[model samples]
Target chain A: MAEAGAPIIEAIGLTKTFKVAQKPPGFAASVRHFFKRTYKEIPAVTDVSFTIRPGEMVGFLGANGAGKTTTLKMLTGLLHPTAGRCVVDGREPFARTRDFLSAITLVMGNKQQLLWDLPARDTLRLNAAIYGISDADYKSRVDELSGMLELTDKLDQPVRKLSLGERMKAELLASLLHGPKVLFLDEPTLGLDVNAQVAVRAFLRRYNERTGATILMTSHYMADITALCSRVLVIHEGKLVHDGELAALLRRFGTRRELRVELSHAVDDAKLRTLGEVLSHEGNVARLAVEPAALVAVVGRALAELPVVDLTVHDPPIEEVVGRVIGKSQRALPNVVGAEQGA
Target chain B: MNAALRKMGGLLSVYYAYMTAYRAELILWALANSLPFILMGAWYQAAAGGAFGFTPVDVTRYFLAVFVIRQLTVVWVIWEFDQDVQRGRLSQYLLQPVDPVWRYLAAHLSERVARLPFSALIIALFFLIFPPARFVPHASDVLLAITFATLAFALRFVMQYTLALFALWTERASSLESLMFILYLVLSGAIAPLEVFPPELRELVMWTPFPYFIWVPARLLIGGADVDLMRATVVCVSWIGSLLVVNRVVWRLGLKRHSSMGA
Candidate 1:
C-alpha cells in the first residue's frame, strides 16, 4: 500500500476548470449578457496526476494554453485546483506556509522578482532577510552565485541598467540565495540569445548537479528540455499523454533517419531507391530516408555500389518527431498540443 | 516577529534608497501638496480684517498646520494597490515567503520621511510670508498631535488599502475611491476647516474618520484643547482596530478570489 520513500512532489486527480462569461458582439447583446450572462466551464487541467521523486529533473511539455502554465501555477500555490490535491515536500502547496515557501523557488522568465529601480544586491538582501538567512550565509550565497553567474560587477548596478542576460542571472541569484530544495521554472530561457541560453542551460545543469534540487520545468524551447531534462511529462489539451524518459519518447518516434551521400560520379534516382526512399537527388549527391535497423546496411550498400565520396547520417528532425507524437493524440482532436513544431 | 522586523528593515532601506534616488518625483509630490498654501492665501485674503471667527494670522496658522498634516498622513497605497492587482504585479509577491503588506507600508512611510524636508521648506515659506506666526501650540500638545498624526497616517493607509482590495472583484474600484476622496477633501478639513461648518454638521463630521486625519491635528496645533485630543485618540484607535479587522477579512476573501479566478 505504501512505498518506503514517497515522492517529494505528489499530485492526484488534479482538475481545474474556469468559469468564463459568454458575451455576444453587439451593444444590445452585451447589455443583455451583462444582466443575465451565460457561462462556460473551460477545463484547464483535467484529472492530471503524477509524482516526482526527490532530486529528479523533469520537463513539462505542451503547446501554449495546453495547461502547462496552469499546472505550474497550481503547483507553485499561485492558483488552487478546482478538484483534487497536490503536495510538495509533505506540505499542501495552496496552504503556502512559510516553511513550504522557503523550501521551494519558482522562476518565471517573463516575470521578475527584482525591484526595477533598485540595485540587484538590495533585492537579494531583501530576499535573504525575508527567508531569514543569516548574514554570513547570505554573503556566502550571494558571492558564490554571483561568481558562478559572472554577476559580481553587475550586482551594484540598477536592474534596469543591466543587460537582459545579466538581469536573468541576478534573478537566478535572488531565487537561489535561500538554497531552496525544489525549483519550478517556467520558460526560464525564453527570448534569450543563443550564447545566453547555452550559458543558462549550463548553469542550471551545474546547479542541479551541485544541489540535487528537484526541478519541474516547462519550456517552449525544445533545446532547453533536451539539454537539461532526461524525463518529461507531456500534456495536451488538459490531459497527460506521455510520461516517461525523454530518450525513450525520442527513440520511439524518432526512428526515421536521413542518409546523405555524395558520390564520385552521377547516379540515377531509381538506383538510389535501392538503398532507401530517395528524398532528393542533385547530380551525384542524394538524400534518402532509412529506418533505424537498416541504417548500417543502407550505408554499406551506398558505399559499395555507388561512387560514394562523402556520407553522413542524422536523426529525423526533432521538431517533426515531436509533432507526430502530439499529432497522434490530436487526430482524435479537440485539444491540439500547442504549436508543437519547435520552441 | 524578529524575522518580520528584519525583513521590514530591508524593505524600508530599499524604499529609502529609492526616495533619495528619485528626487524629481519627490519634488513633484511636494509641489502637489502645495494646494494647502493656495487655500491658505485665499482664506487669509478673505479674513484680511478678521471675519469668519478668525483673524488673518489665525487663518495662516490653520492652513500651515493643514499643509504639514497633509504631508504626513496622505498616502498613495490605493493607487499602488490598484496598479498591482490590475497588472498582476502581485504575482511576484505571492511567490515569496514574506507577506507583501509590509512592502507597501514601508514605501508610504518612506515617502513621508522623504517629504519631511519639503514640509520644513514649506514651513519656512509660511513663516517668511506671515512673519508674526507661531504655528504650534504648547510643547505637550504638539507632541501629542504628532503622535495622533502618526496614527492617523496608519489609519488612512490601512483604510484606503482595504477599500482598494475591491479592485480584485471590480475593475472600477477607483471610482469608489474617488467618491470617497471627494468626501474626505470636503469634510476632512483639507479644503476648509471643519469649524466653518454649522454646529450640527460639525458634530456629524466629527464622528467620521475624516477629522482625525486632518482637523484634529490642525486644530491641536492652533489651540491645545484636551477635549479634541481625547476625541482624536478615541476615534483614531477605534477606526484603526475596526479597519484592521475588515482588512483581514477582505484580504482573505480577495486572496481566495485571486487564487481561484487568476490575477
Candidate 2:
C-alpha cells in the first residue's frame, strides 16, 4: 500500500542536454550544413532535484535560459531527462502510461489545448469522454468549474471569440475536469489584467485547498509567488541555486528595504545621506535603503529631524531580490524589468 | 439504450460543429476533388468505341467507382502528424486519458461524414444521367467486399500513420508522403483499371497492398465479385493485421526517441 502522505513528485539528479547544430550566418554555411554539419552539446538543465509532498504548491523561479521550463517539462513527461530520474506519483513520467497521463495535467499560457473552431462545451465533453469520467461526475465537475470561473455564459461560444482572460479560464476548467492529481502550470496568468490575475490566483488556492492536488508552477510574476506559494525553487543558468521557504529567499537576498520619505520641505541630499544611504533625491521626495534592523530608528530620526510629510517602507520588489540572489550584478537591475514580468 | 446512443450522438454533433466552422474549406476541397471527374471524361472520350476490351460505359462505371473509393479512403495523417509534433500540440493529447489515435480517427471520420451529403449529391447526379447498375451482389460476395473494404481502410490509415512517425527523426515527412502518394496512384489502379494493364503488371499490382486500398474495392463494386476474390480479401486482412502491429511498435519506439530528444 502507498503511504498516505508521501511526496507526490520526486526527482533525483535530473539533467538534460541538447545537441544544437552550429551554423554560420551565410548561404555558404547553410550549404555546408546540408552536406557536412558540426554539432555542439548545449546543456539546458543540470543535476537539479527536488520533491513535493502531496497537495504542496511550489513556485519555480529562474531567469531566461535558467532551465526552469525544461525542468518542468521533464517532470510533466513532456521531455526525458538526459541523466538522472524523476517519479510522479510512483510512475515514471517518460513512460507516459495511460494511467499516469490520466492523473496529471499541464497548462501552458502560450500554448492552448482547447480546439480553436469548437466551443468550450465541446472541448469539455471531449475531455470528459477521454478521461472516462462518468456522466454524473462530468456534469457535477463542469457545473462546479463553471460556477467558480463564471464560464456558464461562455461555454457555448467559440473559443476564438473569447478574450485572452476568458479563454484561459475555460482552458483551466477543461484541463481540471478530469480531476487530475498533479498540475504543472506554466505561466497560467501570462497576459491577464490585474483582476483576472487575482481571480485565477484565488481559484488556484481554493482548488489546491479543496482537492489536495500537487501543483508545480513557474511564473515570472512575483505577486503569484508571494500570494500562492510558501516555498520556491530558484534556478539560474541550468543550475539550482536556492530551494526553500519563500521567506528564506527574501531574508538571504532581500537584506535591504526601501524607505520613501516625503519631506515637508526640500531636504539637502547630504543630510539624507547622513541618515541612510541616499538612493535617490528629487525635489522634496527622497528614497533611502535602510537595513531592516535600522528601519525603525532611521524613520524615527528622519521624522524628528526632517520635515517629513509622508513615509512608506517596502521590501525591494521580488524581481530585484531574485536578480540579486542569482548573482547578477547590481548594474543589471534595470534588465530585471524584462524578466518574466506579470507572469 | 437511448443514453448510450446519446453519447455517440453527441460526438457526431460536436464533429458537425467543427465541420460547419470550416464549411468554406470543405467547399474548396470538393472543388479540388473534381479532377477525377475530368480524368473520367478524358478517358471516356478516348474509349468512345472500345479500348482494352472496355467500352465507354465500362470506363464510366469504373472511374466513378474509383472516385467514390478515393474520396472515402482519403486521409492526411502525414501533415497532421508533422504539424502536431512540431508545434507541441501532441502534448495536449498526451495530457488526456484518451488515446490520441482515437481522437485522430474521430476527427478523420467526422470530416468524412461532413462531406458525405455533398458527395452523395454528386453520385446521385451522375447516376441520374448515366444510370449504372445498382451492383446487387451475392450475400457471400457482399460480406467479402464489406470486410475487405474495412480492412483496406484500416491498413491505409495505419500505414500512413506509421510513415508519419518518421517526423520524430527527420523533417521530410511531407516528401515521404508525396512519394507514397505517387506509388499509390500508380499501383492502386486509381488512374486506370488494373485489367487494362499488361498481364505481368497486373500480377504484380495484385501482389502489393496498394491495389487493395482502391482498386480491389472499386473492382468489386463495378465488376462484380468472384470466388477467387476471397484469396485477395484474406491478403488484405493479413496486411491490416501486420500493419497494426507495426503501427504500435513504431508509435512506442518513436515516442521513446521523442521523449529523449525533448522535441
Candidate 3:
C-alpha cells in the first residue's frame, strides 16, 4: 500500500501513439487502398508527466481530442502507452494485478459499465463479487455510496428506466463500490443537467473528503472543475501545457480583461481602437480587450475620450481561459507552464 | 475458495436474470437452433431407401439427438465480444479484477439455464408429433451424452472466443468466426451423421474435433454409434487445452493493441 500523503498517481514521460488507417477518396484509390491500405501515426498523448497526491482533486482541462481521455485510459490500463511509465497506487496500472485493480476505478461519462436491462443493484453485486467485497461489506458500501449519491431509492430500478442524472449517479455508485483509492473520471458530468451536475460535483467532493481518494477528472463543463478541484492540469496537442492551481491558470491566461462600454452618442471605430483592441463596435457601445495592469488607465482614457454612458470591466470566463490554454501551441505557452518535476 | 464461489454465483445469477428478462427472445433463440429437425426429412427419405445403412427410424432419432446437442452447445461469444471491443465496452470489464471471459462464460451458462425449459418443451412436442422417433436410452448413455455435450459447448465457445480476440486488431473479427462456422456446419455432422460418410472419410472425421461436437454425442444418445469413447475424451480435452493456450496468448496481445475506441 502507498504511504499516506504519497503520490497515488504518477505519470513519467508518458506517451501514446495510434496507427490510424487513412482511406483515400476516389474509385481507383479505394481499390488500391483496399489492397494496400496506408496508416498514419497519430500522437494522442506525448511526453506528458504529472503526479497527484492522495486526496487531491485535480481537474484535467482540455478541448475535444486534446488527449485528456487518452491520458486517463493509460492511467486506468485501458490502453497501454507507447512509451513512458505510470504507477497508480504503488503498482504499474497496465500490469492490472488484483491489488492494483482493487485500488483504482475509471468512470467515463459517455460510456457505461452498467447492465442496462437489469437493475443497477445487479451490476453492483457483480462488481462487489469481482472486487472481493464480502456480502456484509457490499451492503454497507452500497448503503453508504447510494446515500451519498442520493441514489438509494433508485438502485432497484432498471438502468434504462432511470433518468440520465440518476443513471450517471448509479454509474458513480457502481464504480465506487470497491472503495478505490484513486479515480480517473472522464467527463463524469457530461450531458447532465445543471442540478444533476451540481449533485455529482457535491458527491465527488464528499467522496473525496470521506475516503481521502485521489481524483483526476476531465470535463467540458468548467463549473465541474471550479466547484470541486483546487488544482488543474491543462493538456494541449497531446502535451502538458500547464499544471498548477486553478487560480494560477486564470491568472496566466487571465491577462486580457473584457471591457464593455456603453456610450451616449456614436463613437468613431478608429477612436475606440486607440484605447485597446476593439472586439466589437456598434453605434454607441463597444467592447475592448485590455491588459489587467492597464485596466485603470484604459478605463479612464475611454471615459475621458468618449461620451461613455457606462463602462464595466470583467474577467474572462473560466471556460475561455482554459480554452486558450488548451488551444494555444506549446511554443506559445509560457516557459514556466510545464509538468511539475518532483510533484 | 469461498470468495471465488460467491463471485461465480453472483455472475451466474445476474446474467441469468438478464437472460430471463427477455422471455420471448429466449424462446425464439431456442427455436432458432432447430435446423437439425428441418434436415431430418431429407435424411429420412434416404434412409427409407436403405441407401445409408440405416432405417428411417435411425435418421429421425439421430436428428432429434442433434437438435438437443445443438441447443446445449450453441454459442455466440464472437458476436458479443466483437461488439464489446469495437464499442469500447470491454474496457469496463478490463478495469475489474476478474477476467472478462468469465462474464461472457457466465452469460452463456445462464442462457443455457434459461433455454432448457424451452428446449425440453420443443423436444416433447417433437416426440408427440412423431412417436416413431421416440426411444428411451440407457441411463449410462444419457449421462455420457450430457457430459460430451457439455464439453462440446466448452470447445465451441473457446474456438469462437479465440477468433473473437482478433477484434483487437481488426474490429470485425466475427467474420473469421463466420468462415470457421462454415467448416463446422460442413464437417461437424450438423448436416448429416458421420455414418453416411465413406469408411476412410469417417476415420478421418473421427480424428478431427468436428464429430465430437454433434455426431458422437447425438449418436451416443440414440445408441448404435461405433465410437471410441476414450479417444473422443482425449481429443476433446486436448483441443480445449490447446485452444485455451492460444486464447490466452491472443488475449494478452489484444490487450496491448486495444485502443479503447468510442468510449
Q: Could you report the DockQ of all the candidates, in the order they appear?
A: 0.58, 0.36, 0.48
| Weakest 10 consecutive residues of candidate 1 chain A by summed lDDT | A334-343
Residue-level lDDT tens digits of model 2 in A264-315:
8896788999878887898999989888999889999988999989999866
Score candidate 2 by lDDT.
0.79
- Report every candidate's CA lDDT: 0.83, 0.79, 0.87
Residue pairs with backbone overlap in model 2: A220-A343, A221-A343
Worst 10 residues of 2 chain A by lDDT: A334-343
Clash count in backbone of candidate 1: 1
What class would a CAPRI assessor give candidate 3's docking? Answer: acceptable
Once fitted onto the true fold, the runs of candidate 1 whose alpha carbons sit more than 4 angstroms away are A1-4, A254-322, A330-343, B133-137, B224-227
Which stretches in model 2 have alpha-carbon errors above 4 Å? A254-319, A328-343, B1-13, B128-146, B225-227
Instruction: Give the higher-DockQ candidate: 2 or 3.
Output: 3
Please report the TM-score between candidate 3 and the true structure.
0.90
* Tens-digit per-residue lDDT, B1-263, candidate 1: 78778888888888888777788878778879888889988988888956687788888788888888888898877788888887767877888887778889988888888878877886887688778776547887688778878887988888898988887777446677788899889999889988789999998888889888888887776774534667678878999999999999998998888888875
TM-score ranking from best candidate downward = 3, 1, 2
Count: clashes, candidate 2:
2
